[model samples]
Target chain A: MTKKIFPSWIAVDWGTSNLRLWAMDDTANILGSAESPLGMNAIAGDPKLSFEAVLIDLIEDWLGAAPAKLPVVICGMAGAKQGWLEAPYCDVPARPSDLAKGAVTPNVTDPRISVFILPGLCQRADPDVMRGEETQLVGFMAQNPDFAGWVCLPGTHSKWAHVSTGMIRGFRTYMSGEVFALLFQHSILRHSVDDTWDDASFADAVRKASEQPTAFLHSLFGVRAGALVAPVGASVAPGASVLSGTVIGAEIADVLGLLQPGENIALIGAGKLASLYQAALAVHGYRAALQDGAAITLSGLRQAHDTLISPPQET
Target chain B: MTKKIFPSWIAVDWGTSNLRLWAMDDTANILGSAESPLGMNAIAGDPKLSFEAVLIDLIEDWLGAAPAKLPVVICGMAGAKQGWLEAPYCDVPARPSDLAKGAVTPNVTDPRISVFILPGLCQRADPDVMRGEETQLVGFMAQNPDFAGWVCLPGTHSKWAHVSTGMIRGFRTYMSGEVFALLFQHSILRHSVDDTWDDASFADAVRKASEQPTAFLHSLFGVRAGALVAPVGASVAPGASVLSGTVIGAEIADVLGLLQPGENIALIGAGKLASLYQAALAVHGYRAALQDGAAITLSGLRQAHDTLISPPQET
Candidate 1:
């Protein structure tokens, strides 16, 4: 824990497996921050008893001696039906900035705080739902307020939202990350792959799969056959890379197919996942500009707070 | 265990998860049949001890004091490199009748039995392999003596063999079945699908996949999102059907791409799997003649026996 400072308001990003919060001044700059593995999976029983108690405890020191109650805007899985509040989804052909239109305020027993959960977005025609990515979409909208391009947020459920002017024309979701993780970690293919990856093989595989997407299943089987001749207990980087490329490439092909001739792609994610998407996108002739995930998450939360529930001035 | 019977020859289909055996008279007519959970996975330590002992024990009653040693033909995973005996794969672009060219005789302690493990087939260019399916291919050839078309053997690892004039020109292996099993049984998609399948949805999904072959990840995620509103505890038949169709359709598309003009398709499998494939194949303007799997396996083994190991006096 770092030295605590008094803050005007708070922004929370609560997902299935992790929780992150930032204390901010009236000007929207982060004053202090904290995080925990306690997320939706950690919540138990009633929100008033379990959710509020844990949340209050986490921000207890930061709340020290501040007489006025602080306002909080939250995003992510915390708004899921199983989360703290069921903030119903706003169906697409809609903008992420309008997510607040479907927001729901959770009842918190703690008089020191007020919480509003931002709703996620959904696509009815295809039947897809995203929780926290809505905020990132907002954050993306905030960063490029007048931008007209494709904003891709890659993750377990990677999302690609088409933005023109200020509204989302349409968006599609791909479980590419989920496919890779599931195949690598739990499938029979697990025996033939490892954490290692090869860039050249990955790029080559991307092209192969995108060209002949029907060959997906065979390429996966190839990993199993390829692993046999590898050195005993050796790294399966080459195989893993090929499999990863195949999965991502198929995804890129699908999303890119939905793109207009020269629609630019702007990526709103961070770290290795973002880099992988960048490399994958580059192979397809689209250079995606990386948008820092943390920055956008905070920015999105700040935007939500400012628009929906600005803090009251203190004495 | 039925009444003990003395048989002139025996056939064994030993796979990774289960084992099936048949006792046959000199006329290639079945005398008795049996099955057990003991399979290739059951083999432990030295094959001479664990494999042969369990196998002999399984058929000790059938052995019944016959003067001449009984000849036994074996197929499937039991002949894998890691099986009871290392029966090397016969390289292909060759006829299934020539599979015996790569057969290996496993040394057995029981003088009552002379055991031969059937060799599987392998492809050099693509580096793909199959053990039991080769026997099925042999079975297929037995039924359609002069067939020149495609023989699809769908299962855990689905195989499509391009057959023309008594030989397999080339074939490809797809892990679509494995993908569905791994995803439905072990991955996060488990909660979102079930055993029940909807024909309409399945057929529609098959068409969609065969046409696009790229929007696969979205459809998988659709299963998850769709599960939320499904009837209480009701099986996700519709979703499961869609997924199964997608996987199988992709496979069909890949194999069909290899076809020259308008060729026929023969499906060699049994029961539900065969019917499901039948419906999927029908969607793509091809009506596959379904061959009984058990019969083909037996007939193929019988042909192998008659050609390579049958007694001289067969009147």
Candidate 2:
């Protein structure tokens, strides 16, 4: 009996501040996972260096006894302008196939390693763009073929995309995480509350922001004075929560306001961030579905790899 | 004629992070001025030491030559809950006379000094409050008795107040300055530009933010990605300008949106901050009247001090 040897595929999602890698079987089940701090930002100036070196350091034990040659598909800021190699931006209303068909540049120093780089997605309507989330969205769609409407991936630059019939129609980004961090760390409000968001305060802020949406800008400044003048009573958590909730509520309101009524919304990503978006959407009277970000990215990378191996038959 | 000697009033605006002193005649013209880094924050927890030592060190020569019993009216965060003394907060919609009527406590160890600490102003709306700016606003109103409108004092926590019928009707705070610093210093957008604001970018971001106001949240995240992906194209001048303009523009849009149509706005501050507020207001189709912050604070302090010395006649 002849032993059947299956090809092992690797998926990598590298961003500005962090790097994540996944090892999967031919069927795309996760065999192992590895991550590192060696993000694209860590080695921006030098593009010729192998990102694989960092990856190998993180997961050499996982690949124990495996052959040196392995096929890997990479996405995100790793292919950005200052990333390991420039993959360029794919203009808007982009597709999964657009990413699959994008260029692949082998590491100049290592021929055994084939690196398929993914292109970023951009739109002209609002000049909105994304470098890696599109692949995750594709992966998300592959798992739930019937899923449609809006998919929101919350993060430093949170993305809200319109997905229908397997195509990413359009999307927008919100700097919620960065704004929250700025207010909490650098603003006078930093003196109030503990590190984490207080639930009661957050809920109160969400309610206030939703009710008086127009006062978001005016309310943000209160964070500082509230702390200075009334520290004991004025918890930074509520003030920050209010500032964050107002800005985010305003953004969600603006985005949803533009959409036609009855447009479904799906919340992606993980933990507090995704919950915040989900809560914001709910506050606005929208029923949004939730998706696991890790699952979406893994599925998306596998689908892209499969499509590349065997081109889909045209309808 | 018996030579009349006017009581020398030593005005000190002491706060957590700064200390400013003014030697004034009975008429309130400045004779000599001094400032130092010995703000309240610089000496918060130490009880054994006093700001008096730092004050005397900075102005020993002037103090020795001037009256031995000069009275000082202190304002700002110097009298906050954690300040040298806790002066407490006065409820908002406060009048110049009301501010003057606020309480002060003499220094425990210094019998030669009569320190009248100014109280902060608090509002029921969002329970927002402020301290030093109220005194400054009082000074502003004292300087321009006929002026009435929305007075915006831009800083770490920008304050926007409605001044009508000689009273501050309502006020709001916006974390514009802190947001600007965070985006410039810590975020990925730092490399996109210098501190200079380009007219074109400022106008463009303001216009964009005004039209799609929610974009402010998303555009903030762009600061990071912009630095990483398109650092070369992100015009440093325009980028910084846009970052500031976007926050200010969003603020204006929210504040204006809350107001009844055709409401006038006035900006009170100095230098770049004042100009930014002025330009932001203009983008929203409102021409702001400018007021000097220093002049206002000085005038307000004088008015408050005068009221403390004189009782109002019953009307």
Candidate 3:
């Protein structure tokens, strides 16, 4: 017989295109988990009703009828101005665990649910902001308290953070991932590029882009022009790989310039993207350790939950 | 009564999306002109039949019944592999007038027309090619035979040609225009950007991009982040302007590095794009002269016609 378990609280990661949930017991162990495609960008009607309806539909089993209110901690774009509630950005260098300090609570008519949205992190000097990645940073620091160096989270908008002693020093976001998607799917390069692996071509492109970053636009055009004129003797097409290398290489070069000779570097992601970044980093003569992104995010949300349940002593 | 006039020759500029025709008199003056939306790309059927049909449809009035074969000099995508005829690329550093040397003739049963599609210019070393722009270069050279320096053709695929002694020394293409369009219309930045001019904001962004060219993708993300965290108090939105400045500045920075301090630069296009390039150049402490694109193209076609009618004696 399956045992009926009720969660003490819930964790939500609502981003632009996805809404993920984790039901956790008091001990911070996940009892159950759920996900939905109803991301922030998909909600066009009432934000409050829509978000509540989606949340309730996904976790109805966890919410006992007319039971005492269960706290729900949320992160990501769900805290933006256009989200369920606007959670102001906390400027760095600030502790990732302190995300709850600037968090905003949203009003809910459902007696079973109480929602608290975590604030994102921003760099006032450089005009940069992160909605969901800050929580991941919090989770990462919790796992590696003594860690002091760079943490890269590669995705649609790849983010790199400088952390020290549990505080996020500063961060920068690169649109390379989104740029690559747009160029491959929409730009003139679409005609020439195809899914194919060419390690030599990719490495050569990476080296070229890293060495002469300024000539990036010129090099981008070469992707299409090269296919038209040169047509490399590869069994599979190399344009796609070359394009990927060029983009990732430029990002690496920019970040590499900011860093000194030796520094601890870790990538907070998994799968092909993480491997690609690791390969790209190798191209730049740097080694980076990999971390589970989902785990780090959960750890971050748990930190926020702990803060909510046990507010710091009046000091 | 309307006077009927017949042309001595015809000049055609058939690009990927549009087909243009210019009926020229014996003195190289335009007698009448026609245009059609059936460009090279629109013709999916047999190239010979489609091209001939489209040509007859647009210039039927110019073609009299049982008339002598009229010479037609064509340029641009009409000479591409998928075009009406494949006019092989002539390698640079080649004189623009020498385009006709590699021209391909397409057989026609129209009885009233004879066609010669001019070849494009390609740089084998750099792997760059220009179709319609080469014809414009030829025309520009015909007008200013003594001119030598840099010629900038700003468009979807901006081309910068280094010219000296009536030959295209080399050329480079930048897809900044297409990239700007793709980003503004499809990228996440679309939510933040709008069409409003802010000269100061634009200039500032241009300066930043020009200074740190490698940090382009990072700076691109800044457009959205800046709007989100720190909304500027300008009467109109500055995100769009900032985006434009950032893209154009990067291009100028890349090109500026290749050019000398005193090299004469002329932009070979009119209206907003040319003006924008001129404004962007001014930000880098340089001035550029603008030329009418259409006039230059007509002149180039005239030169090709002259070459066809009166072949230079072999030395």
Question: Across residues B11-95, which tens digit of lDDT does each residue of candidate 3 receive?
Answer: 9988888878899989988998888878887885544558878887877788766457888899999899888878988889987
Candidate with top lDDT is 3
The pairs that clash in candidate 1 are A76-A132
Error of 2 at B35 (Å): 3.3
Choose the strongest candidate by DockQ. 3
Note the B-chain TM-score for every model: 0.87, 0.86, 0.92
* The 10-residue segment with the lowest total lDDT in model 1 chain A: A306-315
Q: How high is the TM-score of chain B in model 2? A: 0.86
Cα displacement (Å) at residue A267, model 3 = 1.2
Judged by DockQ cut-offs, the docking class of candidate 3 is medium
DockQ scores of the candidates: 0.47, 0.40, 0.63
- Off by more than 4 A, model 3: A4-10, A23-32, A41-72, A107-115, A145-149, A231-236, A305-315, B1-8, B25-28, B44-71, B108-114, B146-148, B231-236, B311-315
Q: Model 2: which docking level applies?
A: acceptable
Clashing pairs in 3: none
Off by over 4 Å in 1: A1-6, A45-50, A60-70, A107-114, A146-149, A195-197, A228-238, A309-315, B1-8, B25-27, B45-70, B108-114, B194-197, B227-238, B309-315
For all predicted structures, in order, the TM-scores are: 0.86, 0.84, 0.88
Q: For candidate 2, lDDT tens digit of each residue in A1-315?
A: 533333376788888888888877876677778787778878674666457677656555544345665667888888887777788777667667877888466464444456788888876546567888988888877876676677888887778888877788888787667767776776666665344555566665666665665555665655545554555754345555656676577667657756765567777777877888888787767767777887888788888787776679755
Residues B1-315, candidate 2: write the lDDT tens digits: 533333477777786777888877877778778788778877776666576666656555554444466567888887787776777778777787777677677564555566688888888546678889998888877766776667788887788887877888878887667777887888767777675657777877777777765567766655444443443555433578778877778777767765654456777887877888888778767787777777778887888778776656634
Candidate 3 lDDT, A1-315, residue by residue in tens: 645669999999999888899999989799989889988878744445477778888888888664678999999999987888889899998885568788888887777899999999988677799999999999998898998778899998999999887789999999999999999999999887887778878887888888778877788988887777764573433898889988988888888878754567779999988888998888876677788888899999998888887876633
iRMS, candidate 1, in Å: value is 2.8
